[model samples]
Target chain A: MRNAANLRVQVESMLESRIPSALTPKIKPPLESMSCGISDIDRFKAFGRGTLVEICGAPSTGRTTLLHGLLAQCTAGGEAAAVIDTSDTFDPVSASQSGVVLREVLWVRCGVPRNQGRALSRLDQALGAIDLLLQNGGLGLIALDLANVPIRDARQIPLSAWFKFRRAVEDTRTLLVVLAQQPNAGSSSATMLDVSQSSVEIEESDKPSVEKHIDGDCLIRTLRNRAEVLRGQMTKPVRSVRTIGEFSTSLYSYR
Target chain B: MLYAGVHLPNFPAQAALRNDAEARQKPFAVVAGTPPQVRVVALNSHAKKMGLWVGMTKADAETQSSVKIRERLVRLESLAHAALQDCLAGFSPWCEDVAPDLFVLDISGLSNLMGTPVQIAKSIREQARTFSLYIKIGVAHNIDSAIHAARLTKNVLVLPTGGEAEILRDAPLEILEATPEILGILHRWGIRRFGQLAALPELALSERLGQEGLRLQRLTRGISTRILSPTVPSMAFEEEMEFDHSVEDLKSLAFVFHRLLGQLVLRLATRALAAGEIHLTLHLDLAADGVTAKEPFFTRTLKLPVPSVDVTLLLKLLQLDLEAHPPGAPVMKVVLHIEPMRPRVVQNGMFVPQGPEPQRLELTLAKLRRIVGEDRVGSPELMDRHLPVPFRMANFTPSNSPSRKLPAEVSQTAVRIFRPALPTSVEKVRGTPRRVRFSGKSYQVSHASGPWRRSGEWWTRGHWGRDEWDLVLVSGDNKRIVVRAYRDLVTGHWSVEAEYD
Candidate 1:
């Protein structure tokens, strides 16, 4: 009985040596989405990768405020972003002031049209530029600034183009943000934020024009206003551009 | 232990025959010197069979038989010999170039890896054949014996160890390179065969011929062993192709390019390397009418974003670049040279977001550059100045390090600049621009601040002085817009410089 037990043990050990140990394959975790860093905005929604976000509003509606917020968030997070400016309207001075790492952002300026006659071709050029940027993946966010281009010309951008952009960002962790005069990406956008100014306060400047005024005049009214932020689909009626005074126009500086 | 010798009798002719398939079939010899004094410097196997030899007058050879003579390129012979040495290095690292036509390789331990002596010889012969070289290989116990066996044998001869003396016994003494005086004395003594030399009394021979004769006897006995001082082998990863006719179509040219790139990539892979930069040289076929015919050489370098051996990616990049900058004339010849580098080994962090392949990003950037002007594309870099729009374009190279998390404490207003500031007409009230007309629209100033003055570069051209204002304007529809308008103090012109978002 002892000999049989020894033989059995030997056979078991040999079998164990012959069979390789099984290893568990590593499962990768999901990547985190980039946030705009605004308490009200980031809390409500974060700009996920492979998604399109649109921000459009009338002039002084804080459309640029949101755009800069996203740029600062991306650059400060140590990620690179590109802005395809259709009207050549990117200010580096203000971008740096907003905590944006200018080194991380690729700014491409498509020359602005001098008149309405050149607007159509200029828009086409901008679209072509955006297409190139979209294909060059590795960016955290690609903001298409078409706010200065006429809304009619921007609307002329076919749905197929938007669909192509949607497909390009599908598998990659890049957020495509379109800043236009109005909602243009339509249903192709995953999140839409419509900004519109509700009121304007005219504050007379305390500095006298008599000091060193050019054109021999003084004290132009200073602009002060609040804008409403409507988040969701543009087709919905529940979202309105009514100011709850949550937004401020005061100078926010960080050294 | 064993050694081997690879000897090509007429190296110059063989080197010339390389890559010329049609010429190899006919009897040919390479002639040197000018005109009447020209003599045959090297001959091929067919010419040898026709009783032609090197140093024969070129005129005499041409008259004696139907033979074609080509100018002997001394420079080409040197380069080809060096290339042959590099090719042989693939088999064994130890190779000594005893002569321009002959090389001895240390093949002692290669039998297990490459096969028997005959198999190894055949493999080396095959490699030489790629360069259109016909060679004889001899394997023996020592380098000198291997050289003698290779020079005398038709193809391959393997002299077993301890049999070198016996094998060399029948070989003639003329094959030995001895001094003329020693040779005359040996001839007078009738010591012709190596066996006779080996049988000579060592003390007598040494006393008569001194150290020279004693060394010769030792060589005849095959007892000498010396290390092979191999040249430092350089990597050659370049290939050239000349089309039968000029290739006007890009597709045809691309097809040829694809094949050449594949060949080069394979060569790099053999050496465990990757191409850092692929330089392409195109020889264009100029039109008959010499209308501003620029020198027909057009060259471009495709610098890989990252060193890679992947053929598909490289081909795609080349295709895109060529499409952007097409050749001015039809291409007759294309030569590709690769700067080789070791492939980078990257270990990605587990938590890092996977970015696009560097090669892919590079290709895309190139395409963007083509679409937009070169100056218009790339990352934005802030220039050192307080001037409005102090920035320039720089190359876009994204870092692969871990993403930085900015503290929430820092926040500031962001500003976007207008490339060419918009021209505007302003209505000044109390020395402030209270109303503005821009883009065919009027904005009633709701509130405004600043007449901040700035000026610079007064001594240089493009001197500038400007007064800036931050304004909030309300249109007739009650829509409000914030803008910064600057007045050029020199020209007294007001323009919208930028918009705040």
Candidate 2:
């Protein structure tokens, strides 16, 4: 009978050992994926619907011309565009002559107060108008023209403020462009397009008298510096300037 | 009471079946979408016998064994949970799915009835093998130790009373659930392994790593103070409708978008939640070009605002934007996403009359933009520059606020014209005339003004050099036209740059 009980005990033990535990538990974590890389802008030609680009330069530079070309390209491609005129400098006739579709372009004029007693007050009002527009979102390109706004004042803008602006633009499809007269010292996130005038040359003359009629050409230089390529070829000090018109001078010189 | 915990790597049951059918006839491997990919999803002993390794790519495995492949029907996780519950039902009334391949079995009362902790673990392993599933067992004083030992050490780890710290000290940092950023920080600090972290002073760790450091310290010591809270029911509400046929054009896509928006709005209205953002996804048929047996290309996720549930408004916006800016090609399918619904509440004023909220203005503008097109609306902003005539303008989006203060010096030096003088018609004379006719009027050049010459930006391609003259012209009708004329230094032609409006 004892031997029989031993065999039963062995069978019971085998069965008891088969039971699973309830103390331990398993948990799975979520998986993360990799992001794709950015290719050349030209590769995204048809995909430039909401792209924003900025052109910056010193006095007598070609900032406006570049903007005109971009607008003309968009219009030529049958795409509509809007221009916010803070300095009241957009010449619609000239834009039309440059192959821009007049019907496709919307021009908004933000007037600088003519009767502002002080220049500083006028600047403040102008900037305030721009500030108001930026607080509202949803534009393919929002270009803030600071060409007329002096470089000193542009630099006076705190770095922290630019950082805030960058953050606001983060992850949004909209492109925020800032045009400046000079390189406004700040972080590398802001794309800087620098325009500079090279030289003036007289190439032709219509009249041969003492008061000689002259034809002149102006040279313009464009430099595009972005954050990703800042460390490499950007250090090259070479500047490219293209001559616009050549002048044939009789006898004329500036003091 | 005897309890057993079974872990069948990832998709082990299906993997076993696939292997058994092939009978070492083909090389096979399982792929789990995990990093390093070394952690085996599953491997059949037969395939292993053919020198095939787990985590090998499908292509590589086929090249090796030329085996007939069978994909798993159910997720590895659900199948393992069901299997574990079935096998351990007698030992514990409760069983929990711990992870993709692990489980927790409550065997507290069964320890006395079972032979010994080691014997119980062995029996469990033996039973699991019958089903072709491999499991690691740990017999510890508590759940934390048991789980740690089961996951970290070997098949069977019996921890002594105070050996928890020693057992876990040599483990890798990956087991700590450390983020990439935190891991980088630890690596820079020369704390490569878990033992180094465990040996650090709590005060120093906290000061350097902040709250995360404190949590890491606790985890390293195997002192998981966190309780396993019961899973809460998901509150997310989503509805999906499958199309009878694959959609390939904008019209069909728009139809789907309309239907989806209606359903989403109805659901949101019932919940009293206002959806601010919506995401639309399209699935395209990919089998059209005979590229594969599957359907052709499909598009997904076209995000838009969710201010109103109006299907017409949504459709109009979508159609307009698409016509103005169409996707690269025809899209096949679409899915709409309405995100983060908040309680719809509007605070009204009792005394003073309330005006429309700013958000309403946005909606109105959005509608106008849809009709007129986005590029047709906005205020003109000056292109920041130190140049004249060639000033660029930007679209006035309300969000481009000036975050920084303008310097006082710059405002003083720059001359800002209120309006760009429209260059009206100019009378061309044989020579540089003292006075010129403009706008059907003549004016005497009072101060035959300046030759303010400006040259072109040649580096940017286009160039222009013009000698400008600010002529104070007075007409016979007594009308004054302060005209600025420039003789193009390049073309030898004269043109009026600006005229006083």
Per-residue lDDT for B48-149 in model 2, tens only?
Answer: 777667667655556655454444434433433444444444355445556656655666676678777777777767756543456787655545555656
The sequence of per-residue lDDT tens digits that candidate 1 reaches over residues B31-71 is: 99987899999888788899998899988888856687878
Model 1 misplacement above 4 A: A1-32, A75-78, A106-137, A198-246, A249-255, B1-33, B36-141, B145-159, B163-223, B234-273, B277-305, B310-342, B403-411
TM-score of chain B of 2: 0.39
**Candidate 1 docking: what grade?**
acceptable
Per-residue lDDT tens digits of candidate 1, residues A42-114? 5445366677877777766666766777778877666788888877777766677666777777777666432
Kindly report which residue stretches of model 2 are placed more than 4 angstroms away from their true locations once superposed: A1-255, B1-242, B246-255, B262-316, B327-330, B337-358, B363-374, B386-448, B455-459, B462-464, B471-480
The top-ranked prediction according to TM-score is 1
User: Model 1, residue B235: displacement in angstroms?
Assistant: 6.9
lDDT of 2 by residue, A87-185 (tens): 555666445544445444545444433221233333344444334434554433344566666677777776665666556554443344566666553
Per lDDT, the best of the predicted structures is 1
